[model samples]
Target: MPISQAAQRLPDDAVYVRPRMAHYAAVSRQIMAALENISPSVEQASVDEAYLDVSGLERLIGPPETIGRQAKHIIKNTVGLTASAGIGPNRFIAKLASEYRKPDGLMVVHPHEVQAFLDPMPISALRGIGPRTAPALRQMGLERIVDVRQTDPALLERRLGLRLAQVILNQAHGRGSDEVQLHSVRQSISKETTFEQDIVDQARLRETLLWAAQEVGRTARREGLQGRTITLKIRLENFKTFTRQRKLPAPTDDDTVLYRQAWALYRESGLAEHPVRLLGLGLSDWQQDAPSQGDLFDTPSHPSEHAQTPQRDRRTRLFQTLDGISNKFGQNAITLGLRRKT
Candidate 1:
C-alpha cells in the first residue's frame, strides 16, 4: 500500500521518528570490530549481515558450530543485539542458511549436507530470483532448486537472460565464491524523512533540509571523507520522486555548504509548489583523506559569502566547536542557526 493509504489506516497515536543512521553505523562498527577479534577474515555484507571465514580456525575453535556460536555470543555481548549465523561450504549455502533460521538462530550446512539442505527449497529461495523471476520459473514447472538443476541450461537461458540464468544455476547447485573481503568502503551517506502529513510550506521544507545536511556533514567529518556532489531528493504527495544535484567547486564536509548547495538545487527544481511527503539529502563522490589545509586557509571565489577566505576559517572553527559540544553532550545539544535572526 502507498504510504498515504497506510497512514490513513494507522492509529492516531502512532509514533514516527527520523532514523538515527549515524548511531546505527556506530553500532555496526562495534559489531564488526568485535567479530574481527574472532577471525580477521570478516566481510561485512551489510550493516547487519557479515560473512566470516572460520575454516582456518576450525582447529583452534573446535569446529564451524563452535565458531558460529562464539561469534553470536560476542555480537550479543558487545552490541546487545541477537544475530543469526550460517555455516556452509561456500558463500551461497552460507547466506541461505543464515536466512533459514533468523533472529538469534544458527544453522550449519556441512560439505556433505549441502545438496540435501538446498534441493527441496523453493526456486524463489535462490538469490536474485525474486517475484518477477519466480513467476517465470514456476511457469516452466520449475518449483524447486532440484527442478532448476534438472532443467536444461539452454531452455533456462531462453527464458531468462544468459547471465542471470547462469548465476541462478550456479546458486541452485550450491556453488559460490568463498572468499571473504576483510575491508569495504561505503560509497555514500544519506538521510531521509517521511512525514505523517504532506507539507506545502517552503520554510518547513528548508528546515528539514538543514537538519539532514547537519547529520550528513557530521557523519562525513567523523569518517574523514568529503564529497564533490550534493544531492537533493523529493517525493511529492502523489508519490512522484525526483532528484537534483550539483557538483561543488571542490570537495566539502561542511554542513552549511551542503545545505546551501541542496537548497539551491531545490529552488532550481521548482518543486516548492507541490505538497511534499518526503525529503532526503545525500553526499557522494567520495574523496577519502582529502588534503584540506589549502581549502581551509585559501578559499576559492564563489557567489556565496561563505566561500570567502576570512569566513572560511570562521566557519571551520564554528563547526569544530559544534562537534566538541556534540561529542561532550549529544548531537542535539547545540544546534547551528540556519539563518540570522532579525
Candidate 2:
C-alpha cells in the first residue's frame, strides 16, 4: 500500500505509522549475527540480505538444505522474524532461489540443474532488468532468459548497448561471480534535502547546496578521506532529476572547494528558471590523506607555488580551525561568511 493509504488504515489509537531507521539497524545487526554463526565468510548484500560461503561446512552442518533450514531457524530464534534462504553453487542462482520461495521458505539449486532452472524464467526476472530496459529486451524478441542465449551478441548490443547486453547474456548462461567478499570499503559520502515546497529562489538553492557540501566535507574528514569528484543533484518540481559532476585535479576534503565545484555544476545544469524540490551534493573517487613530501627541485616561479598562494593556504588553515571548533562545540557553533546576514 502507499504510505498515505497505510496511514489512513492505521487505528485511531496508533502512536506512529512510519519507517524507523534505528529499529531497522538493530534488526540488521541481529540478522548479521545469525549469518556469522553459519559462516565466517559472509557478504552483506543489503540491510535485509546477505551471502554466506558454506562450501566446506557440509561435513559439520549436513547438506545445503539442512544448513538453509538452520539459518532460517537461527534468524527466527534471534531476531523474531522469519527469513527465506537460497542454497546454490553461485550468488546469482542463490539470489533467485531465495526469491523462488520467499517469506519463510528455502529453495536449493544444484550445480547440474543451474541452466535448466534459469532457462524457463522470464528475462525480466534477471538482475538489472528494470521497467525501462525490459521493454527494450521484449522489442528485440527476447522475452525469456533462454532467448538472450539464442540472440546474436551484436544484435543485442545494437538494442541495449554493449555493457548491458554482455551482463544480461552472462546472467542468462547462469555464469555469475560467486565470490563472497567479507569486507566492504566506503566509496562515497553525500548529503541531500527535499524542501517542503518547491523553491524558485536561486539564493535559497545555493544556500542549500552550501549546507550539503559542508555536511559531506564534515563526514569525509571524520572518515579520514578526500575525494576527486564532486557531484550536484537537482530535482525539479515536475519530479525530473538531473545530476552534474566535476573531477578535481587533486582530492580535497575542504567544504569551500566542494561547494565551489558543486556551485559550478549547478550553474551548468541551467535549472535556475525551474523550481527545485530537492538539492544534493556528493563526493566520490576517494583517496586517503597522506603526508605531502616537498620536492627538492621546487622552483620559486613554479606553477605549483602559484597554486598554493599564502591567501589560499591561510583560508585552508582557517577552515581546519573552524572544523576543530565545530567538533569541540557543535555543528552550528561556526558559520561561513557567505552564510552571514548582510
lDDT, each prediction: 0.85, 0.81
- By summed lDDT, which 10 consecutive residues of candidate 2 come out lowest? 290-299
Query: Once model 1 is optimally superposed onto the true structure by TM-score, how far is the C-alpha of residue 110 displaced, in angstroms?
Result: 1.4
TM-score of 1: 0.83
User: Candidate 2: misplaced stretches above 4 Å?
Assistant: 1-34, 46-48, 60-62, 69-83, 128-142, 147-169, 184-187, 200-211, 222-224, 289-338
Q: Give the per-residue lDDT digits (tens) of candidate 1, residues 1-342.
A: 755576567786766565666688799989999999898888988888899888879888888889899999999999899999999989988998998988788999998999899899998888899879999999999999999998999999999999999999998889999888776767888888888788998788888898998889888988888999889999987668899988876788888788877887888898878999899999999888764422333546776644336656677788789888998999889876767321
Local error of candidate 1 at residue 276 (angstroms): 3.3
By lDDT, the best candidate is 1
Per-candidate TM equals 0.83, 0.67
Q: Scored by Cα lDDT, where does model 1 land?
A: 0.85
- Candidate 1: Cα lDDT at 106: 95
What is the lDDT, from 0 to 100, of the residue 45 in candidate 1?
82
lDDT of 2 at 265: 82
